[model samples]
Target: MTGPRWIAAAWGQSSLRIWAMAGRKVLTEGASDQGVSRLGPRDFEPALLTLANDMLPLDEVTRVLICGQAGARKGWVEVPHAMVPCAPHAAPPVPAPSRDPRISVGILPGLGQTDPPDVMRGEETRIAGFLLDRASFDGVLCMPGLHGKWVRLRHGIVQGFRTMMTGEIYGLIARQSVLRPMMDDSWDEAAFRHAVDESTRHPETIVSSIFGIRASALLNTPAPGLARARLSGLMVGCDIGAMRTWWHNRPVAVLGTERVSTLYASALAAQGADVQALAGDRLTLAGLIAAHERTGHLEPSAAAHG
Candidate 1:
Protein backbone atom coordinates (compact mmCIF):
# COMPACT_ATOMS: atom_id res chain seq x y z
CA MET A 1 0.00 0.00 0.00
CA THR A 2 3.04 2.28 0.29
CA GLY A 3 3.21 3.71 -3.22
CA PRO A 4 2.32 6.63 -5.40
CA ARG A 5 -1.38 7.05 -6.00
CA TRP A 6 -3.08 8.15 -9.23
CA ILE A 7 -5.53 11.06 -9.07
CA ALA A 8 -9.00 10.93 -10.63
CA ALA A 9 -11.03 14.08 -10.53
CA ALA A 10 -14.10 15.67 -12.05
CA TRP A 11 -14.79 19.41 -12.18
CA GLY A 12 -18.26 20.68 -12.92
CA GLN A 13 -19.77 24.15 -13.05
CA SER A 14 -20.39 24.33 -9.30
CA SER A 15 -18.24 21.68 -7.58
CA LEU A 16 -15.02 19.67 -7.79
CA ARG A 17 -14.67 16.03 -6.63
CA ILE A 18 -11.58 13.86 -6.53
CA TRP A 19 -10.48 10.37 -5.64
CA ALA A 20 -6.97 9.17 -4.85
CA MET A 21 -6.49 5.72 -6.36
CA ALA A 22 -3.75 3.26 -5.45
CA GLY A 23 -3.99 0.89 -8.36
CA ARG A 24 -7.77 1.11 -8.85
CA LYS A 25 -8.56 1.07 -5.15
CA VAL A 26 -9.42 4.47 -3.69
CA LEU A 27 -7.11 5.50 -0.86
CA THR A 28 -8.78 8.79 -0.04
CA GLU A 29 -11.18 11.36 -1.50
CA GLY A 30 -12.06 15.03 -1.18
CA ALA A 31 -14.40 17.64 -2.60
CA SER A 32 -14.42 21.41 -3.01
CA ASP A 33 -16.66 24.15 -4.35
CA GLN A 34 -13.87 25.40 -6.60
CA GLY A 35 -15.47 24.34 -9.86
CA VAL A 36 -14.56 25.98 -13.17
CA SER A 37 -17.21 28.69 -12.93
CA ARG A 38 -15.76 29.98 -9.66
CA LEU A 39 -12.17 29.75 -10.91
CA GLY A 40 -10.23 32.32 -12.92
CA PRO A 41 -6.75 32.66 -14.44
CA ARG A 42 -4.02 30.99 -12.33
CA ASP A 43 -6.78 29.41 -10.24
CA PHE A 44 -7.07 25.93 -11.80
CA GLU A 45 -3.81 24.62 -10.42
CA PRO A 46 -4.46 26.00 -6.97
CA ALA A 47 -7.99 24.66 -7.00
CA LEU A 48 -6.81 21.16 -7.87
CA LEU A 49 -3.97 21.22 -5.37
CA THR A 50 -6.32 22.45 -2.69
CA LEU A 51 -8.13 19.12 -2.94
CA ALA A 52 -5.19 16.92 -3.90
CA ASN A 53 -1.99 18.21 -2.31
CA ASP A 54 -2.57 16.63 1.07
CA MET A 55 -3.33 13.20 -0.38
CA LEU A 56 -0.15 13.05 -2.48
CA PRO A 57 3.41 12.34 -1.38
CA LEU A 58 6.02 15.09 -1.60
CA ASP A 59 8.71 12.98 -3.35
CA GLU A 60 6.73 11.07 -5.95
CA VAL A 61 5.32 12.30 -9.21
CA THR A 62 1.53 12.07 -9.26
CA ARG A 63 -0.62 11.41 -12.30
CA VAL A 64 -3.98 13.19 -12.58
CA LEU A 65 -6.94 12.38 -14.82
CA ILE A 66 -9.68 15.01 -15.05
CA CYS A 67 -12.88 15.57 -16.95
CA GLY A 68 -15.78 18.04 -17.09
CA GLN A 69 -15.79 21.80 -17.54
CA ALA A 70 -12.16 21.95 -16.42
CA GLY A 71 -11.35 21.24 -20.05
CA ALA A 72 -13.80 23.78 -21.38
CA ARG A 73 -12.66 26.77 -23.44
CA LYS A 74 -12.77 28.88 -20.31
CA GLY A 75 -11.51 26.09 -18.08
CA TRP A 76 -7.94 24.91 -17.50
CA VAL A 77 -7.37 24.22 -21.21
CA GLU A 78 -9.54 24.02 -24.26
CA VAL A 79 -9.57 20.37 -25.37
CA PRO A 80 -10.81 19.68 -28.86
CA HIS A 81 -14.01 17.68 -29.10
CA ALA A 82 -13.49 14.04 -30.14
CA MET A 83 -15.70 13.87 -33.20
CA VAL A 84 -18.39 11.19 -32.90
CA PRO A 85 -18.56 7.81 -34.76
CA CYS A 86 -15.44 7.12 -32.71
CA ALA A 87 -14.61 4.85 -29.82
CA PRO A 88 -15.08 6.23 -26.36
CA HIS A 89 -11.32 6.55 -26.04
CA ALA A 90 -10.53 6.71 -29.75
CA ALA A 91 -8.72 10.06 -29.71
CA PRO A 92 -5.94 10.57 -27.24
CA PRO A 93 -6.86 12.98 -24.47
CA VAL A 94 -5.62 16.58 -24.59
CA PRO A 95 -2.34 17.02 -22.78
CA ALA A 96 -2.51 19.52 -19.92
CA PRO A 97 0.95 20.32 -18.59
CA SER A 98 1.63 22.52 -15.63
CA ARG A 99 4.41 24.66 -14.12
CA ASP A 100 4.33 22.38 -11.08
CA PRO A 101 6.37 19.33 -12.01
CA ARG A 102 5.08 17.35 -9.06
CA ILE A 103 2.15 16.12 -11.12
CA SER A 104 0.96 15.69 -14.72
CA VAL A 105 -2.67 16.17 -15.79
CA GLY A 106 -4.61 14.90 -18.79
CA ILE A 107 -8.04 16.21 -19.67
CA LEU A 108 -10.35 13.90 -21.55
CA PRO A 109 -12.02 15.40 -24.60
CA GLY A 110 -15.75 15.75 -24.98
CA LEU A 111 -17.88 14.63 -27.94
CA GLY A 112 -19.60 16.69 -30.65
CA GLN A 113 -22.20 16.36 -33.41
CA THR A 114 -21.78 18.39 -36.61
CA ASP A 115 -25.00 18.66 -38.59
CA PRO A 116 -27.47 19.19 -35.75
CA PRO A 117 -24.88 21.20 -33.80
CA ASP A 118 -24.50 19.64 -30.32
CA VAL A 119 -21.69 19.17 -27.79
CA MET A 120 -21.10 17.57 -24.35
CA ARG A 121 -18.10 17.45 -22.04
CA GLY A 122 -18.17 15.58 -18.73
CA GLU A 123 -21.06 13.31 -19.63
CA GLU A 124 -19.01 11.70 -22.35
CA THR A 125 -16.53 10.44 -19.79
CA ARG A 126 -19.35 8.97 -17.73
CA ILE A 127 -20.67 7.13 -20.78
CA ALA A 128 -17.23 5.80 -21.58
CA GLY A 129 -17.05 4.39 -18.08
CA PHE A 130 -20.46 2.73 -18.41
CA LEU A 131 -19.41 1.09 -21.64
CA LEU A 132 -15.97 0.14 -20.39
CA ASP A 133 -17.19 -3.27 -19.33
CA ARG A 134 -20.20 -3.51 -21.62
CA ALA A 135 -18.55 -3.55 -25.03
CA SER A 136 -21.67 -5.00 -26.60
CA PHE A 137 -24.16 -2.49 -25.23
CA ASP A 138 -25.96 -0.80 -28.11
CA GLY A 139 -28.75 1.48 -27.09
CA VAL A 140 -29.69 5.00 -26.01
CA LEU A 141 -28.21 6.72 -22.95
CA CYS A 142 -30.32 9.28 -21.10
CA MET A 143 -28.22 11.57 -18.90
CA PRO A 144 -30.43 13.91 -16.89
CA GLY A 145 -29.09 16.95 -15.10
CA LEU A 146 -29.41 20.74 -15.38
CA HIS A 147 -29.08 20.01 -19.09
CA GLY A 148 -30.14 16.46 -19.97
CA LYS A 149 -28.41 14.55 -22.76
CA TRP A 150 -29.76 11.88 -25.08
CA VAL A 151 -26.90 9.89 -26.61
CA ARG A 152 -26.52 6.99 -28.98
CA LEU A 153 -23.94 4.32 -28.29
CA ARG A 154 -23.36 1.56 -30.87
CA HIS A 155 -20.90 -1.29 -30.37
CA GLY A 156 -19.21 0.63 -27.59
CA ILE A 157 -18.69 3.70 -29.74
CA VAL A 158 -20.34 7.04 -29.20
CA GLN A 159 -22.41 7.52 -32.36
CA GLY A 160 -23.94 10.93 -31.59
CA PHE A 161 -25.95 12.76 -28.95
CA ARG A 162 -28.20 15.74 -28.24
CA THR A 163 -28.79 17.97 -25.23
CA MET A 164 -32.01 19.21 -23.65
CA MET A 165 -32.59 22.22 -21.41
CA THR A 166 -35.53 20.70 -19.61
CA GLY A 167 -33.97 21.21 -16.20
CA GLU A 168 -33.23 24.86 -16.98
CA ILE A 169 -36.77 25.46 -18.19
CA TYR A 170 -38.11 23.74 -15.07
CA GLY A 171 -36.01 26.00 -12.91
CA LEU A 172 -37.29 29.10 -14.66
CA ILE A 173 -40.93 28.19 -14.25
CA ALA A 174 -40.60 26.66 -10.77
CA ARG A 175 -38.41 29.37 -9.27
CA GLN A 176 -38.79 32.57 -11.28
CA SER A 177 -42.17 32.60 -12.97
CA VAL A 178 -45.67 33.24 -11.60
CA LEU A 179 -46.11 29.48 -11.72
CA ARG A 180 -43.56 29.22 -8.96
CA PRO A 181 -46.00 29.71 -6.12
CA MET A 182 -48.04 26.67 -7.11
CA MET A 183 -45.16 24.17 -7.12
CA ASP A 184 -44.66 21.89 -4.17
CA ASP A 185 -41.28 20.76 -2.94
CA SER A 186 -42.34 17.13 -2.77
CA TRP A 187 -43.10 14.78 -5.65
CA ASP A 188 -46.55 13.47 -6.55
CA GLU A 189 -46.27 10.41 -8.77
CA ALA A 190 -49.89 10.37 -9.90
CA ALA A 191 -49.89 14.04 -10.77
CA PHE A 192 -46.54 13.72 -12.50
CA ARG A 193 -47.66 10.88 -14.78
CA HIS A 194 -50.95 12.61 -15.59
CA ALA A 195 -49.06 15.63 -16.81
CA VAL A 196 -46.58 13.53 -18.76
CA ASP A 197 -49.28 11.65 -20.66
CA GLU A 198 -51.34 14.75 -21.36
CA SER A 199 -48.38 16.90 -22.37
CA THR A 200 -46.80 14.26 -24.57
CA ARG A 201 -50.10 13.72 -26.27
CA HIS A 202 -50.87 17.41 -26.61
CA PRO A 203 -47.84 19.66 -26.10
CA GLU A 204 -49.90 22.62 -27.30
CA THR A 205 -51.96 22.50 -24.10
CA ILE A 206 -48.93 23.08 -21.84
CA VAL A 207 -49.27 26.88 -21.99
CA SER A 208 -52.90 26.82 -20.93
CA SER A 209 -52.11 24.27 -18.23
CA ILE A 210 -49.24 26.43 -16.98
CA PHE A 211 -51.67 29.27 -16.40
CA GLY A 212 -54.00 26.85 -14.68
CA ILE A 213 -51.28 26.17 -12.05
CA ARG A 214 -51.41 29.79 -10.91
CA ALA A 215 -55.18 29.87 -11.09
CA SER A 216 -55.50 26.64 -9.13
CA ALA A 217 -53.12 27.99 -6.51
CA LEU A 218 -54.79 31.35 -6.20
CA LEU A 219 -58.41 30.22 -6.26
CA ASN A 220 -59.14 26.56 -5.74
CA THR A 221 -55.89 25.56 -4.03
CA PRO A 222 -56.72 22.15 -5.38
CA ALA A 223 -53.82 20.00 -4.08
CA PRO A 224 -50.35 20.29 -2.53
CA GLY A 225 -48.17 18.55 -5.15
CA LEU A 226 -50.52 18.79 -8.12
CA ALA A 227 -48.87 21.80 -9.71
CA ARG A 228 -45.32 20.69 -8.99
CA ALA A 229 -45.78 17.23 -10.49
CA ARG A 230 -47.65 18.57 -13.49
CA LEU A 231 -44.94 21.16 -14.17
CA SER A 232 -42.15 18.56 -14.00
CA GLY A 233 -44.02 16.05 -16.10
CA LEU A 234 -45.05 18.65 -18.67
CA MET A 235 -41.50 19.82 -19.20
CA VAL A 236 -40.03 16.30 -19.37
CA GLY A 237 -42.88 15.14 -21.57
CA CYS A 238 -42.16 17.90 -24.05
CA ASP A 239 -38.48 17.01 -24.10
CA ILE A 240 -39.24 13.34 -24.71
CA GLY A 241 -41.74 14.27 -27.41
CA ALA A 242 -39.17 16.35 -29.26
CA MET A 243 -36.69 13.47 -29.15
CA ARG A 244 -39.13 10.66 -29.79
CA THR A 245 -36.79 8.98 -32.20
CA TRP A 246 -34.25 8.50 -29.43
CA TRP A 247 -36.50 6.84 -26.87
CA HIS A 248 -39.70 5.78 -28.55
CA ASN A 249 -40.15 2.10 -27.63
CA ARG A 250 -36.39 1.79 -27.47
CA PRO A 251 -34.49 0.57 -24.42
CA VAL A 252 -32.53 3.28 -22.66
CA ALA A 253 -29.92 3.38 -19.91
CA VAL A 254 -30.30 6.51 -17.80
CA LEU A 255 -27.27 8.02 -16.12
CA GLY A 256 -27.90 10.52 -13.35
CA THR A 257 -29.03 10.63 -9.73
CA GLU A 258 -31.93 8.71 -8.21
CA ARG A 259 -34.54 11.43 -8.62
CA VAL A 260 -33.69 12.45 -12.16
CA SER A 261 -33.00 8.97 -13.52
CA THR A 262 -36.01 7.48 -11.82
CA LEU A 263 -38.17 10.15 -13.35
CA TYR A 264 -36.76 9.45 -16.79
CA ALA A 265 -37.27 5.74 -16.25
CA SER A 266 -40.86 6.32 -15.28
CA ALA A 267 -41.49 8.59 -18.24
CA LEU A 268 -39.95 6.22 -20.76
CA ALA A 269 -41.60 3.17 -19.21
CA ALA A 270 -44.95 4.86 -19.61
CA GLN A 271 -44.23 4.91 -23.33
CA GLY A 272 -43.50 1.13 -23.27
CA ALA A 273 -39.74 1.70 -23.34
CA ASP A 274 -37.38 -0.48 -21.30
CA VAL A 275 -35.35 1.71 -18.97
CA GLN A 276 -32.41 1.18 -16.58
CA ALA A 277 -30.73 3.81 -14.45
CA LEU A 278 -27.06 3.91 -13.48
CA ALA A 279 -26.39 6.56 -10.86
CA GLY A 280 -23.76 9.30 -11.36
CA ASP A 281 -20.89 9.05 -8.83
CA ARG A 282 -20.01 5.38 -9.35
CA LEU A 283 -20.00 5.56 -13.14
CA THR A 284 -18.15 8.88 -13.37
CA LEU A 285 -15.32 7.44 -11.31
CA ALA A 286 -15.34 4.29 -13.42
CA GLY A 287 -14.93 6.39 -16.53
CA LEU A 288 -12.06 8.39 -15.05
CA ILE A 289 -10.27 5.25 -13.89
CA ALA A 290 -10.79 3.63 -17.28
CA ALA A 291 -9.25 6.64 -18.98
CA HIS A 292 -6.20 6.49 -16.75
CA GLU A 293 -5.76 2.75 -17.28
CA ARG A 294 -6.20 2.88 -21.06
CA THR A 295 -3.99 5.95 -21.44
CA GLY A 296 -1.37 4.47 -19.11
CA HIS A 297 -1.44 7.64 -17.04
CA LEU A 298 -0.99 5.31 -14.07
CA GLU A 299 0.98 2.20 -14.86
CA PRO A 300 1.26 -0.72 -12.44
CA SER A 301 5.06 -0.67 -12.53
CA ALA A 302 5.13 3.03 -11.71
CA ALA A 303 3.42 2.38 -8.38
CA ALA A 304 6.31 0.18 -7.22
CA HIS A 305 8.81 2.94 -7.97
CA GLY A 306 6.77 5.39 -5.92
Candidate 2:
Protein backbone atom coordinates (compact mmCIF):
# COMPACT_ATOMS: atom_id res chain seq x y z
CA MET A 1 0.00 0.00 0.00
CA THR A 2 2.91 2.36 0.62
CA GLY A 3 4.90 2.03 -2.56
CA PRO A 4 3.10 -0.02 -5.23
CA ARG A 5 0.58 -2.88 -5.44
CA TRP A 6 0.30 -5.40 -8.29
CA ILE A 7 -1.35 -8.43 -9.90
CA ALA A 8 0.21 -11.01 -12.22
CA ALA A 9 -1.28 -13.17 -14.97
CA ALA A 10 0.46 -15.43 -17.49
CA TRP A 11 -0.64 -17.94 -20.10
CA GLY A 12 1.00 -20.42 -22.41
CA GLN A 13 4.69 -20.83 -23.23
CA SER A 14 5.42 -17.16 -22.73
CA SER A 15 7.76 -15.96 -19.98
CA LEU A 16 6.89 -15.07 -16.39
CA ARG A 17 5.82 -11.47 -15.70
CA ILE A 18 4.53 -8.84 -13.22
CA TRP A 19 2.04 -5.94 -13.22
CA ALA A 20 2.22 -2.96 -10.91
CA MET A 21 1.18 0.67 -10.60
CA ALA A 22 3.54 3.64 -10.67
CA GLY A 23 2.00 6.89 -9.40
CA ARG A 24 -1.49 7.19 -10.92
CA LYS A 25 -0.63 4.96 -13.88
CA VAL A 26 -0.64 1.16 -14.22
CA LEU A 27 2.57 -0.46 -15.43
CA THR A 28 2.72 -3.97 -16.92
CA GLU A 29 6.02 -5.66 -17.70
CA GLY A 30 7.88 -8.97 -17.65
CA ALA A 31 11.28 -10.65 -17.87
CA SER A 32 12.28 -13.24 -20.48
CA ASP A 33 14.93 -15.07 -18.39
CA GLN A 34 12.45 -15.76 -15.57
CA GLY A 35 10.23 -18.10 -17.57
CA VAL A 36 9.26 -21.58 -16.30
CA SER A 37 8.48 -24.86 -18.03
CA ARG A 38 4.91 -25.31 -16.78
CA LEU A 39 2.75 -23.94 -13.92
CA GLY A 40 3.28 -26.90 -11.67
CA PRO A 41 2.98 -25.36 -8.17
CA ARG A 42 6.32 -26.83 -7.18
CA ASP A 43 8.14 -25.31 -10.16
CA PHE A 44 6.25 -22.00 -10.11
CA GLU A 45 6.98 -20.52 -6.68
CA PRO A 46 10.71 -20.15 -7.25
CA ALA A 47 10.08 -18.72 -10.69
CA LEU A 48 7.44 -16.36 -9.33
CA LEU A 49 9.77 -15.21 -6.57
CA THR A 50 12.53 -14.76 -9.13
CA LEU A 51 10.21 -12.76 -11.35
CA ALA A 52 9.11 -10.70 -8.38
CA ASN A 53 12.71 -9.93 -7.49
CA ASP A 54 13.55 -8.85 -11.03
CA MET A 55 10.49 -6.62 -11.67
CA LEU A 56 9.31 -5.36 -8.32
CA PRO A 57 10.35 -5.30 -4.68
CA LEU A 58 8.53 -8.37 -3.37
CA ASP A 59 7.49 -6.71 -0.13
CA GLU A 60 5.73 -3.86 -1.97
CA VAL A 61 3.28 -6.05 -3.84
CA THR A 62 0.16 -7.11 -1.93
CA ARG A 63 -2.13 -9.53 -3.77
CA VAL A 64 -1.25 -12.09 -6.47
CA LEU A 65 -3.54 -14.34 -8.43
CA ILE A 66 -1.53 -17.11 -10.09
CA CYS A 67 -3.25 -19.01 -12.84
CA GLY A 68 -2.50 -21.02 -16.01
CA GLN A 69 0.32 -23.57 -16.31
CA ALA A 70 2.50 -22.03 -13.63
CA GLY A 71 -0.38 -22.10 -11.20
CA ALA A 72 -1.09 -25.78 -11.93
CA ARG A 73 2.21 -26.98 -10.54
CA LYS A 74 2.02 -29.44 -7.64
CA GLY A 75 3.87 -27.83 -4.70
CA TRP A 76 3.80 -24.20 -3.61
CA VAL A 77 3.48 -22.82 -0.07
CA GLU A 78 1.89 -19.52 -1.10
CA VAL A 79 -1.49 -21.14 -1.68
CA PRO A 80 -2.38 -23.61 1.04
CA HIS A 81 -5.96 -24.80 0.55
CA ALA A 82 -8.45 -26.24 -1.91
CA MET A 83 -12.12 -25.50 -2.48
CA VAL A 84 -14.56 -27.84 -0.82
CA PRO A 85 -17.00 -29.97 -2.79
CA CYS A 86 -20.48 -28.68 -3.40
CA ALA A 87 -23.62 -30.79 -3.48
CA PRO A 88 -23.97 -33.17 -6.42
CA HIS A 89 -26.80 -31.22 -8.11
CA ALA A 90 -26.19 -27.98 -6.26
CA ALA A 91 -22.74 -26.88 -7.28
CA PRO A 92 -21.90 -23.27 -6.53
CA PRO A 93 -22.46 -20.83 -9.34
CA VAL A 94 -18.94 -19.42 -8.89
CA PRO A 95 -15.66 -20.30 -7.24
CA ALA A 96 -15.46 -19.64 -3.52
CA PRO A 97 -12.82 -17.37 -2.05
CA SER A 98 -9.75 -18.91 -0.46
CA ARG A 99 -9.93 -18.93 3.35
CA ASP A 100 -6.50 -17.35 3.63
CA PRO A 101 -6.32 -13.89 2.09
CA ARG A 102 -2.54 -13.40 2.04
CA ILE A 103 -2.29 -14.63 -1.58
CA SER A 104 -5.10 -15.93 -3.75
CA VAL A 105 -4.18 -18.70 -6.19
CA GLY A 106 -6.28 -21.22 -8.02
CA ILE A 107 -4.92 -24.13 -9.99
CA LEU A 108 -7.43 -25.24 -12.61
CA PRO A 109 -7.38 -28.93 -13.32
CA GLY A 110 -6.60 -30.25 -16.78
CA LEU A 111 -8.96 -32.55 -18.65
CA GLY A 112 -7.43 -35.93 -17.90
CA GLN A 113 -7.66 -39.32 -19.63
CA THR A 114 -10.51 -39.33 -22.20
CA ASP A 115 -7.67 -39.53 -24.74
CA PRO A 116 -4.49 -41.04 -23.40
CA PRO A 117 -4.62 -38.67 -20.40
CA ASP A 118 -3.83 -35.67 -22.57
CA VAL A 119 -2.99 -32.65 -20.41
CA MET A 120 -3.17 -29.18 -21.88
CA ARG A 121 -1.18 -26.92 -19.57
CA GLY A 122 -3.11 -23.77 -20.54
CA GLU A 123 -4.62 -24.08 -24.03
CA GLU A 124 -7.38 -26.51 -23.12
CA THR A 125 -8.99 -24.17 -20.61
CA ARG A 126 -8.58 -21.24 -22.98
CA ILE A 127 -10.15 -23.18 -25.85
CA ALA A 128 -13.01 -24.27 -23.63
CA GLY A 129 -13.71 -20.66 -22.63
CA PHE A 130 -13.53 -19.60 -26.29
CA LEU A 131 -16.22 -22.14 -27.23
CA LEU A 132 -18.70 -20.89 -24.66
CA ASP A 133 -21.98 -19.73 -26.20
CA ARG A 134 -21.18 -21.24 -29.61
CA ALA A 135 -23.96 -23.26 -31.10
CA SER A 136 -23.73 -26.98 -30.77
CA PHE A 137 -22.10 -28.70 -33.73
CA ASP A 138 -21.21 -32.29 -34.39
CA GLY A 139 -17.92 -31.54 -36.07
CA VAL A 140 -14.23 -31.36 -35.43
CA LEU A 141 -12.19 -28.39 -34.18
CA CYS A 142 -8.60 -28.72 -35.30
CA MET A 143 -5.88 -26.76 -33.53
CA PRO A 144 -2.65 -27.10 -35.48
CA GLY A 145 0.59 -26.87 -33.53
CA LEU A 146 3.70 -28.87 -32.64
CA HIS A 147 1.24 -31.25 -31.03
CA GLY A 148 -2.03 -30.73 -32.89
CA LYS A 149 -5.42 -31.30 -31.35
CA TRP A 150 -8.60 -32.43 -33.04
CA VAL A 151 -11.39 -31.75 -30.56
CA ARG A 152 -15.03 -32.66 -30.75
CA LEU A 153 -17.26 -30.35 -28.75
CA ARG A 154 -20.92 -31.26 -28.33
CA HIS A 155 -23.37 -29.20 -26.31
CA GLY A 156 -20.60 -26.92 -25.07
CA ILE A 157 -18.66 -29.79 -23.48
CA VAL A 158 -15.59 -31.50 -24.86
CA GLN A 159 -16.87 -34.94 -25.80
CA GLY A 160 -13.53 -36.25 -27.01
CA PHE A 161 -10.35 -35.12 -28.73
CA ARG A 162 -7.29 -36.51 -30.48
CA THR A 163 -3.72 -35.26 -30.55
CA MET A 164 -1.40 -35.71 -33.53
CA MET A 165 2.31 -35.12 -33.73
CA THR A 166 2.02 -33.55 -37.17
CA GLY A 167 3.88 -30.27 -36.68
CA GLU A 168 6.70 -31.78 -34.62
CA ILE A 169 7.08 -34.60 -37.13
CA TYR A 170 7.27 -32.11 -39.99
CA GLY A 171 9.89 -30.03 -38.22
CA LEU A 172 11.98 -33.11 -37.48
CA ILE A 173 11.87 -34.36 -41.03
CA ALA A 174 12.45 -30.92 -42.52
CA ARG A 175 15.29 -29.95 -40.26
CA GLN A 176 17.17 -33.09 -39.18
CA SER A 177 16.06 -35.96 -41.40
CA VAL A 178 17.56 -36.78 -44.80
CA LEU A 179 14.75 -34.74 -46.33
CA ARG A 180 16.47 -31.55 -45.16
CA PRO A 181 18.87 -31.43 -48.07
CA MET A 182 16.10 -31.37 -50.68
CA MET A 183 13.94 -28.63 -49.17
CA ASP A 184 13.96 -24.99 -50.23
CA ASP A 185 13.27 -22.34 -47.62
CA SER A 186 11.28 -20.36 -50.17
CA TRP A 187 7.52 -20.32 -50.68
CA ASP A 188 5.72 -21.44 -53.81
CA GLU A 189 1.92 -21.46 -53.85
CA ALA A 190 1.87 -23.85 -56.75
CA ALA A 191 4.01 -26.33 -54.90
CA PHE A 192 1.83 -26.02 -51.84
CA ARG A 193 -1.38 -26.62 -53.76
CA HIS A 194 0.12 -29.55 -55.61
CA ALA A 195 1.17 -31.09 -52.33
CA VAL A 196 -2.29 -30.56 -50.94
CA ASP A 197 -3.78 -32.24 -53.98
CA GLU A 198 -1.54 -35.26 -53.63
CA SER A 199 -2.20 -35.48 -49.89
CA THR A 200 -5.96 -35.31 -50.25
CA ARG A 201 -5.87 -37.98 -52.90
CA HIS A 202 -3.55 -40.40 -51.13
CA PRO A 203 -3.50 -39.70 -47.41
CA GLU A 204 -2.19 -43.06 -46.29
CA THR A 205 1.01 -42.66 -48.28
CA ILE A 206 2.23 -39.94 -45.94
CA VAL A 207 4.45 -42.17 -43.79
CA SER A 208 6.39 -43.49 -46.77
CA SER A 209 5.98 -40.28 -48.75
CA ILE A 210 7.66 -38.26 -46.04
CA PHE A 211 11.01 -39.71 -47.05
CA GLY A 212 10.14 -39.04 -50.67
CA ILE A 213 11.57 -35.56 -50.18
CA ARG A 214 15.05 -37.01 -50.54
CA ALA A 215 13.99 -39.38 -53.28
CA SER A 216 12.35 -36.63 -55.30
CA ALA A 217 15.55 -34.59 -55.44
CA LEU A 218 17.68 -37.59 -56.38
CA LEU A 219 15.14 -38.84 -58.93
CA ASN A 220 14.59 -35.31 -60.31
CA THR A 221 10.85 -35.67 -59.79
CA PRO A 222 10.22 -32.43 -57.85
CA ALA A 223 12.00 -29.19 -57.15
CA PRO A 224 13.29 -28.49 -53.67
CA GLY A 225 10.41 -26.13 -52.94
CA LEU A 226 7.95 -28.63 -54.29
CA ALA A 227 9.44 -31.36 -52.17
CA ARG A 228 9.05 -29.23 -49.04
CA ALA A 229 5.46 -28.48 -49.94
CA ARG A 230 4.79 -32.13 -50.65
CA LEU A 231 6.17 -33.12 -47.29
CA SER A 232 3.92 -30.63 -45.54
CA GLY A 233 1.00 -31.83 -47.60
CA LEU A 234 1.65 -35.44 -46.79
CA MET A 235 1.67 -34.73 -43.06
CA VAL A 236 -1.44 -32.57 -43.14
CA GLY A 237 -3.14 -34.86 -45.59
CA CYS A 238 -2.55 -37.90 -43.44
CA ASP A 239 -4.05 -36.10 -40.45
CA ILE A 240 -7.02 -35.04 -42.53
CA GLY A 241 -7.53 -38.59 -43.71
CA ALA A 242 -7.47 -39.91 -40.18
CA MET A 243 -9.88 -37.17 -39.12
CA ARG A 244 -12.13 -37.54 -42.17
CA THR A 245 -14.53 -39.84 -40.38
CA TRP A 246 -15.05 -37.23 -37.69
CA TRP A 247 -15.74 -34.41 -40.15
CA HIS A 248 -17.67 -36.43 -42.74
CA ASN A 249 -20.90 -34.39 -42.79
CA ARG A 250 -20.20 -31.82 -40.11
CA PRO A 251 -19.00 -28.24 -40.16
CA VAL A 252 -15.34 -27.69 -39.23
CA ALA A 253 -13.67 -24.84 -37.41
CA VAL A 254 -9.92 -24.50 -37.57
CA LEU A 255 -8.09 -22.45 -34.98
CA GLY A 256 -4.42 -21.67 -35.69
CA THR A 257 -1.97 -19.62 -37.72
CA GLU A 258 -2.97 -18.46 -41.19
CA ARG A 259 -0.84 -20.90 -43.17
CA VAL A 260 -2.04 -24.05 -41.43
CA SER A 261 -5.63 -22.82 -41.38
CA THR A 262 -5.50 -22.04 -45.07
CA LEU A 263 -4.12 -25.46 -45.87
CA TYR A 264 -6.77 -27.08 -43.69
CA ALA A 265 -9.44 -24.96 -45.32
CA SER A 266 -8.29 -26.03 -48.76
CA ALA A 267 -8.31 -29.67 -47.75
CA LEU A 268 -11.70 -29.38 -46.06
CA ALA A 269 -13.17 -27.56 -49.03
CA ALA A 270 -12.07 -30.38 -51.27
CA GLN A 271 -14.15 -32.68 -49.12
CA GLY A 272 -17.19 -30.41 -49.60
CA ALA A 273 -17.38 -29.47 -45.92
CA ASP A 274 -18.15 -26.05 -44.49
CA VAL A 275 -15.05 -24.61 -42.89
CA GLN A 276 -14.45 -21.53 -40.75
CA ALA A 277 -11.15 -20.20 -39.46
CA LEU A 278 -10.72 -18.40 -36.15
CA ALA A 279 -7.75 -16.41 -34.91
CA GLY A 280 -5.77 -18.73 -32.67
CA ASP A 281 -4.35 -16.05 -30.40
CA ARG A 282 -7.64 -14.27 -29.98
CA LEU A 283 -9.41 -17.51 -29.19
CA THR A 284 -6.72 -18.57 -26.76
CA LEU A 285 -6.82 -15.29 -24.89
CA ALA A 286 -10.58 -15.17 -24.85
CA GLY A 287 -10.76 -18.73 -23.61
CA LEU A 288 -8.29 -18.00 -20.81
CA ILE A 289 -10.08 -14.84 -19.67
CA ALA A 290 -13.39 -16.63 -19.79
CA ALA A 291 -12.10 -19.41 -17.60
CA HIS A 292 -10.81 -16.87 -15.11
CA GLU A 293 -14.10 -15.02 -15.07
CA ARG A 294 -16.11 -18.25 -14.71
CA THR A 295 -14.02 -19.28 -11.76
CA GLY A 296 -14.59 -15.84 -10.13
CA HIS A 297 -10.85 -15.35 -9.84
CA LEU A 298 -10.77 -12.67 -12.52
CA GLU A 299 -12.71 -9.44 -12.35
CA PRO A 300 -13.46 -6.69 -14.85
CA SER A 301 -10.95 -4.48 -13.06
CA ALA A 302 -8.26 -7.16 -13.07
CA ALA A 303 -5.38 -6.03 -15.30
CA ALA A 304 -3.32 -8.70 -17.07
CA HIS A 305 0.45 -8.49 -16.45
CA GLY A 306 2.40 -10.36 -19.12
RMSD of 2: 6.8
Give the Cα error of residue 300 in candidate 1, in Å: 13
Give the per-residue lDDT digits (tens) of candidate 1, residues 38-157: 988579999899889888787777788898998888989999888887876676667675777677778888887897898888998898889877888888998988888998888888
Please, what is the whole-model Cα lDDT of each candidate in the order they appear?
0.82, 0.57
Residue pairs of candidate 1 with colliding backbone atoms = none
- Residues 1-306 of candidate 2 have per-residue lDDT tens digits of 322244444434546544443322346555454444444544555565555544444333234444344533442322222211211011112221333333344444444333355544444544554566474555678888777887776656566667888998899988888877777886666666667667767787777777766766787765546767778877877888778878878878888888888888877777677888877755544443444444442432233221
Global fold similarity of model 1 (TM-score)? 0.93
Query: Cα deviation in Å at residue 98, candidate 1?
Result: 2.1
Off by over 4 Å in 2: 1-43, 49-103, 115-117, 133-138, 221-224, 297-306
Residue 238 accuracy (lDDT) in model 2: 81
lDDT of 1 at 8: 94
**TM-score winner among the candidates?**
1
